[model samples]
Target: MSDRFELFLTCPKGLEGLLIEEAVGLGLEEAREHTSAVRGMADMETAYRLCLWSRLANRVLLVLKRFPMKDAEDLYHGVLDIEWAEHMVSDGSLAVEFSGHGSGIDNTHFGALKVKDAIVDKLRTPTGERPSIDKINPDLRIHLRLDRGEAILSLDLSGHSLHQRGYRLQQGAAPLKENLAAAILIRAGWPRIAAEGGALSDPMCGVGTFLVEGAMIAADMAPNLNRELWGFTTWLGHVPALWKKLHTEATERAAIGMNKPPLWIRGYEADPRLIQPARNNIERAGLSHWIKVYQGEVGTFEPRPDQNQKGLVICNPPYGERLGDEASLLYLYQNLGERLRQACMGWEAAVFTGAPDLGKRMGIRSHKQYSFWNGALPCKLLLIKVNPDQFVTGERRTPEQRQAEREQAAYDQAPAEPQERQYNKNGNPIKPAPAPVVEQARLSEGGQMFANRLQKNLKLLGKWAKREGVDCYRVYDADMPEYSMAIDLYHDWVHVQEYVAPKSIDPEKASARMFDALAAIPQALNIDKSRVVVKRRERQSGTKQYERQSAQGKFTEVSEGGVKLLVNLTDYLDTGLFLDHRPMRMRIQKEAAGKRFLNLYCYTATASVHAAKGGARSTTSVDLSKTYLDWARRNFSLNGFSDKNRLEQGDVMAWLEASRDEFDMIFIDPPTFSNSKRMEGIFDVQRDHVQLLDLAMARLAPGGVLYFSNNFRKFVLEDNLSERYAVEEISDKTIDPDFARNAKIHRAWKITAR
Candidate 1:
């Protein structure tokens, strides 16, 4: 080991084995594996290959010399003994990074300065020039690690950490380190699954890190193929011919491997905005053909029956800061466990989460848990075999779990009046026998028609959704007028909006019918009650509809026409997504690619999301409400379109009048009427139609098209407008089949300059 120059390949704490395997795969038989590093005998060619192919390595260091040291002078002489001329010209810029401490060199900066001074002094007279220090983008990188009294000097062959694979241009809220993600896939046994023609999926995939890494592992493609900047590219010791040979071999392997597939890889991100970024990352990695990321939640997760291959379900679910505060997240984990047990039978599961206690809520028993370091947060990869026996239908809860649930439920249902409940004198809580559970009443005759209509529409729209790649849509828009409710399906969650019934009907009878509708929805839909949200929609406008109904603030990510949207079924009356505009979103996406898109009265910025996904160069979404603007920001960031200049919180009219900038495409879908206190004045779409269109068209570039839509059933477009612009009523096309029964949904137009 001492005869040949030894190399040290440092990796993350949990990925030592992968690095060793990678080194061995590259013919480095002298590898000595450790906890966070692998020491091996590697010549220049082998070191170069390590940099190019090792997905688990952080840095590859080629040890030049080692010597005993006692003081600063000894360290200086020891550095000076090595020949620096062989690696770099005296005029080349150099940077030195020193680590560890001892021998009167406790300060890293002081040690690095001493090393630099010695190298410069030795080369100054011989080359008649001195190399300047360049911390950023150095031509030559020198490393010196001192322990006790021994100094080990090496050249940093990898200029920076190899985790920067150069393909991820945008990221999610929390992105996994590429190496750690790769290691997790390997540990989850993805390679074996791929070899056996099995599929891979991530129910909580954020930005498709695991999906992309898994695809790479399955394909046996080099991780660094997308990256162009190599640390050794600048080192003078680099052999071009040897590096070229390795590069050619990788290129050939990739060409052959990319087409080899029964590749069935998929990722599901509940955050609607992250869908586009995930696909973008997958495309960036050149695995667009193999990996597909969709907007979906873990609650609806199931193995595709068509795929028919047993595989792995892995995810990194959110781990909130405090255990007491993450009660809703507990439900997420619990639902995930239940889904895995029911739908993922015979498949393996890996849950990589920061909080092990929270992960316990998944309800599934883990066979093994491997500790990993995700930056500073210590994480665990809980591995389990998904089978019927591992998790049962009516699982019993432990005392601790029951206590945690009780505390969370108490917090969730704090009384508005603040009345104190009964407790024993010793402060010990008293318990009473639980009341017998009441059976839910079946749907009334009127409710039966509503339920039947719901089933009928679900059958109709579900087929259209599958064909159109639309995930969120309206199933019943008050199809049964007696029930007076609009049912919208967001992924697997059913949102039922009950229009306040007329006072002419008996109040008690109305209440009974509403409950019947609620009862019928979950039963007919065949989903749990927890997945349905019922809200009463009264006649209101402006801030009233936007007002909070309850304090249980939560948002679910939903997909519509290939775009992801954030919807809050429980927080407000509107679920953030306007399903009726689903058709318009499709239209906008068709024309948005490589254009400047402007969305006026942009509520939740769903149109902008569509435009950005369409490849719009830039987007501007203006709204008066900060709440909706904040929601829009999340959407923008999710779609990798977070330009502060693009999201504006001001009146659309004022923004339009003030902005002289022109756009290639403009979409205006204003409210019918808004008398909000925040605005300069009231907004009635019917009254403001002319002025709004004039202002919007002024900002529209030559030959640009403007899409105008409004939901005022009795109103009419001004005939005078035809003199200035060419307008066509596109209402028929805008209303999809699901909303066809309700003809007065909304009117749309394609207005253009005459």
Candidate 2:
């Protein structure tokens, strides 16, 4: 091998620039950047050093030769020209990896096989003792890259990817690769921060990757110092003396670095399950003295190192997969921002997220953003300076001004020491200090009015709800036009739905009023603020309303009509059980004795559970969503009504058509509009009601009753059906007291065979 060997260092996409700088710093000569790779020249010593020190590279390839090839034969001869005896023993094992197939080698597998064949043929001895293939741990690993018409063959000097620093055997579900984590730190300016002896913290640290990587960078430690294996360990061209010299120097440097006072590096994770694993990883990285992880939540995250200390707050909060997930994740990002504002003022923050929009919702402005890829998912690193000017609040102030106000507020809020008083000879004092007055947060006038309205409603409805044994009900529904929202009490939890204010309304005022209402809710309801779940409601079409709003996957059990049903308050717009349908479900329970029942569009099977509780012989529920069906199954199992209750997953129209059984009672409450992909075509409740009802009525036995309902305010039943079957409007009877204020909540009817 020559003194200067051509080297190609590969990395994850979007880290090409960072890797180029890092490679040049590690003695790589004349470095040039490529897509996901950096090509340069380095000697054997530099190659070994890069393998041990390059934090951003996935692999280090030492180029053997670059030959032009027009066909597979040329590729075979090109590989054959290399001296196989000098690289590996005749009985050694090797692995070949080929990329960019072309020039009559249409398949990379064929190209690799041809290269291997050429080497094996040349290395075969008189006794046919040839080198065998060892893909895992080989004596030699050759990489052939066919670019355009030229073949570039090289030897792999890094065995397993350099990212496998050997400390992260256990990680969270979505772990950033070690190299990628290092790249993020470098881009976030952790190196410079560490050089300044600044602190570091990760609010959502998963197994302490960032803390360990930051500690390594700050402590001047090589990333792979503890790694026991390397690609060139078994290669014939390996230089043991030169590698030993570089390794000893790196070891001494690390010792000297560790002797310095450790920087204040810490990590906090919300998941208690990850606390021990994070500690284990840090211990493995030999950074236990510098980094500490604690079980904490984002809402309560406080990185209190030393007084007056400020540093980087880096976290990789989860970017949820579904659109509905944004609802919950929005609050997560908000809580993170709130903590940053309250506890980490004057510090810097770096938020890495796949959802840039969610990052924007953090109530902070990013001064700079860099695009990177987490595997195939493109992500963004938002760099923020946690100062007063970067806050999304309408009021703008400089950091100095905010600091002054904070200091003044602290001085003013400090309790005055009790005045020293003269005492008599007895133990009792002549005079005692007056008790301190604790001031509470004052609500706005509109908020007070809203709170009074809620109290009045709760006073009137609480009695009725207790008498009726209702576990869930709507307490207030847009009672005041200014406060256009629906508040529901589910057990101890409060669910508030803020109807999107009209575009004509001044948004700032509306937001202020909503904030006031939110502030008054927990106080009025006498519950903790953490128990409140809020969602913004807007006009929805098709199946958009059914889409998940959060990924909580949490279901709360509630009782109605003597049966237990499950409701997921955070995951969807509708909380499984519809309060307006409570009376209808009770009505079904009243008339379901000894009769067969069927429910179409049986969301969560609440109505079916009521029927089963009413002693129905059997209950059949059908819906298109597997998620709802699963929920319905849980409801059935919760009430011990699983055996005779049939839960079918399919389009209700198709299921009804395919059914031949007869039912004595049927109830259907469907969406106003649906374009679900599972169904063959679109369904508008107003347009398709007749066909849906006709198909459903075909399965109705003689004298059976079918109750069909919908919430479309402008719906009108086909008049001709009244002539075929005796039909009567039953909307008035089904409206419960909770839904009485909004009488247009749903319309219902009873159709029976004439």
Candidate 3:
């Protein structure tokens, strides 16, 4: 017998059709769709199956009871009379969630509080034991929606939001939510395309969410197949036998379809930082074998043997909001269009962009442009088609032709050289007299003079580090014309480095002039002059052990100030220590009295010294480089720490697994990315953090506190982990005087066992 029940399935806007299809596939007859949500009716068993299988829905709400309401008082009374004892146990915990479109109850929190009061009052009146509220994860989730002066109350069948698909153990900056990715694919006609063996590709797949979603759609796999629990499992009216039957049927269906290979799904990204995340995400989605994620510049990407078959290329490239300037974005789009026209013949392309001006640079006439909302900003999805024969034989200039034309114009307008070149001997130009070597040496000496002056100014500021009660002080601003170099003086050491400026006129001259100016500072100050070192920043190549060792050993020297310091004067934007985090380091030092300390992602060990200074009994620091470990040991000795402290040069996860020692205080501050050869693999802050955090906590003593910090701006904590640990955001406290305004630079958390 079919048991009738009202069901609400919420989804992102423009994906209502996909939700309806998912509902119908779950045996829900006569499904109806809304703008950002869907409605339907199904038996209890079908609803359970929908929770397990529906990819597009965010939540599945089951209508438990309904009552008429005229005002707040009436609403409270109506809620109290719903026979709460029958559904919620007197000792069970509950949470009230509300969504209001119109009506007097505009504040969601106020409405939720009133609803909670009503439920508790009813339960207390009968059994004298009212349930408490648990905001993190509640056993019973009561949902209330108020629209047009009417209130609809329902039981949230999905305990947590359906977006917690359990497969995403890692995340990246501005990561598209899983459900949102599914909705986007559905809106892009993925289901229909999947049925016809249509391929999908994303040129700027940040972490391969779109590709994963497209693959899941092609494979007909249930979205919640990996999920551990659902809200329906804890509901009062849930039938265990019926739920099991529905899930088993879906599992059998998935097993039968698992043999089919996923559709051709490909993701390409220029940022090497995203490659690991894309690979991790694809593996997490169980589509690693079917999906191909490549690391390459999108402008230079060539089609593979299979991708040349002319499939669909769907791109969600940077819209200048999250990424940098609009002018550069336009150039990227222009190159993107050129690649499409050159390599992707007989293919259809779609670009989702929020910036319309940049979109115009693509040049290709879009066949269709659909408007959709990505969160709050309105975005346009443009569709363009390429005809294979027309693309090959079109009346367009060849790339070589364009280059030759530009070259000819440049040559015609070129200035003539001096007549000295015409006075040639033996068919060669006349050799000029060799300039005085002393004069050349004098010019180089003048460059060093300016660098010494800048170094002196930096040293003058270091004296105020302890006087100002500041952990660190910035002696130079990289943006300034005269002091374009950045000089950070930490409590233990000073970091001197050059900065990459925005483009300007006479760029080479400006750089050389800046170098000359920076070289004069150290000699001018005469304060521990040897400690002032120059570091040139550049892109890091593949990890090599000798290079790491050289970098570490290069800085091993004692300064005139009686401080043993390791100075890395070449390569890297900043010397290992970010002086702006000085305040947080001091705090760790102050709080480390008589405690065992574990520093995860310990770079250069500046913070470890502070902890040791505060009387830490034992300290264990783990990082990916033996070179960094050696430098860290030097820093500890500079602060008078002995060999009682240990430095393990290995992967943080591996060290965590092997170490049997427990730390009373643990600090985890991983780099955004470190490609080290000595390590088992690369370390990415956004991708491997959850596992790293779990491992760190395993070695933490009972009642120990872990201070975890990261520079990733858009980090989201896992929903399940919050239940086992108490987390408090301490980013505000971590800020120092030098970096007061840039909140995105770092975020710190205080984690403790519940």
* Residue 737 accuracy (lDDT) in model 3: 45
Model 3 TM-score (2 dp): 0.52
lDDT values of the candidates? 0.80, 0.86, 0.69
lDDT of 2 by residue, 637-711 (tens): 455333226778899898988899999999989899998888999999999999999998999999899999998
**lDDT tens string, model 3, 1-754?**
2278989998777667767887898788768887788887888877888888888788999887666666788779879878887686888889899888445676889888888999998888444777989977787999998877778898999888887787676666666678877766766676777788777878777788888878877887788887766675666777999877877876776666567865677887654557887898788877887889875445555654464455678878777544343433555676677778777777777788788666667666677777776777777887777554233224356789678668756754555454323221112233344422321223256566565555654455544443444434565555346445666554334566565554664678767766665444443443354555665444333332115323342443322112233445444445555655666787787899878888887877777767766767667888777656766755653443432356777888788888788889999887667676557777776777788888888888998899988776677666666877898888899875455535566888899888
Estimate TM-scores for all models: 0.60, 0.60, 0.52
Error of 1 at 602 (Å): 6.3
Q: How much lDDT does candidate 3 score?
A: 0.69
lDDT of 2 at 327: 42
Clashing pairs in 2: 324-549
Q: Per-residue error at 628 for model 3, in Å?
A: 31
Per-residue error (Å), model 3, residue 247: 1.9
- Which candidate, 2 or 3, has the higher lDDT? 2
> Looking at candidate 1, what is the lDDT of residue 277?
87
Residue-by-residue lDDT tens digits, candidate 1, 1-754 = 2335688888988788778987888857588997688988867677778888888998888898899999999999999987888888788888899988988878999999999999898778654789999887788888888866889898888887888787777887778889999899888888898888888988888899999989888887888876665566777777789989988998888888887963889897655567898899888899999998875556557755463678888888777631123544555677688778768878999999988997777667888889898987899999989875566444445789678779856754665321233222223333433433434556778678766877777777877876676667788876666678888888778998888889887888878878778877876666567889888899876557777777676878677665666789988888788888888998999888768889998988899888877767677889988778777766654443333326778988888889989899999988888888878888888788999999999999998999999877877898899999999999899988878988788999999999
Candidate 3 residue spans exceeding 4 A from truth: 101-104, 125-127, 388-754
